[model samples]
Target chain A: QQPVQSPQAVILREGEDAVINCSSSKALYSVHWYRQKHGEAPVFLMILLKGGEQKGHEKISASFNEKKQQSSLYLTASQLSYSGTYFCGTGFKAAGNKLTFGGGTRVLVKP
Target chain B: EAGVAQSPRYKIIEKRQSVAFWCNPISGHATLYWYQQILGQGPKLLIQFQNNGVVDDSQLPKDRFSAERLKGVDSTLKIQPAKLEDSAVYLCASSLVFQGLNEKLFFGSGTQLSVL
Candidate 1:
């Protein structure tokens, strides 16, 4: 089952901030965040495992809530280079390395 | 380290035609996966392999779509009698392991297919 993403698309000016949410009906053990620019492969941004372990990469950050089965990605001080599609892939409880992805959220950071 | 490699950066074919895409995963990687990403959507897993043995194909359209990883190295996905709906970017990814919670996927620049 695919997760659901909120704020399907967002447009931001440079130096703006945005939050993308990924929620799944089933509980997830971990959540992986990736960004895919046009015509390119999806690149891993970060992975948030259960128990509220946080990982940050430059201006990108993410958090996972084990109890709620949700993950959120934070993009602070967005730049034009941030324009791309953000996807959240969830590792379900019963599955092993079988991640089901959510409908992506498109972000456009303009000057 | 080199990431997954996919052949045919782009393809254009008419409906009812057949096409195949190849993938070479990162060296020493044990798991490889093929995904179909429709426009404006996240990729959907078509098949997954662990060291030349199929681990998953529940989502794959077995009738016209098939994949194989021979010698636990390179892989190929073939679609016979392609349909318009099959026009999507096919992505290949690999991971070091097929189990556990800390695994990460490395992807290749996908093949963009336009079935006319």
Candidate 2:
């Protein structure tokens, strides 16, 4: 099943901070984040593993709570380049290597 | 590295018509995925391939959709007798390996399909 994302849309000014949350009903082994600009492909952002291992862009960070089956993406000091749709893909042990994505959260960071 | 490549940036067809999209993954990547993204929605996984073999296709509509990754380098997704609801963007992505779904994926620009 697809995960759920909170705050479907958010608007922020430069230098502001925002948080996007993703939750899945099924136990997740890992969570992957990506950003997609209009008319472009989704770009890989970060991945948070169940054991707390995180890897991705140096400037971007995210946290995964294994017990809750939730993950959150933190956008601090937002930049104009951060404006895009954010998606969280969840991986379940039973599903093997398939990653199921969430509905997505749209973020607009203005100058 | 060269990113994943997709053909036919845009396609339009009438209901019941057939349409096909093609994708070429990164040179050394061993895993490929196809996803469908509707307006205002996230990309939904349609199928997954691990070196020319299907790993998952539970979300694919077998009644009208079929896909193949020949030679483990390139793939094609075909929708026959397409329905209006099939209008969306088809995205192709690839990862270096099938490492427990933890590897990052590189995506292609995607093909936009419109069914009238």
Highest lDDT: give the candidate number. Answer: 2
lDDT of 1 by residue, B9-113 (tens): 999999999999999999999999999999988999999999999988999999999999999999999999899999999999998877455688999998999
* Candidate 1: docking tier: medium
| Each model's total of backbone clashes | 0, 0
Candidate 2 per-residue lDDT, tens place, A1-111, comes to: 899999999999999989999999988898999999999999999888889764546556798888888998988888999999999999888877688889999999999
Query: Across all candidates, what is each one's fraction of true contacts kept?
Result: 0.67, 0.78
CAPRI docking class of candidate 2: high
C-alpha RMSD of candidate 2: 1.2
Candidate 1 chain B — worst ten consecutive residues by lDDT sum? B95-104
Tell me the deviation in Å of residue B87 in model 1: 0.5
The local distance difference test score of each candidate is 0.91, 0.92
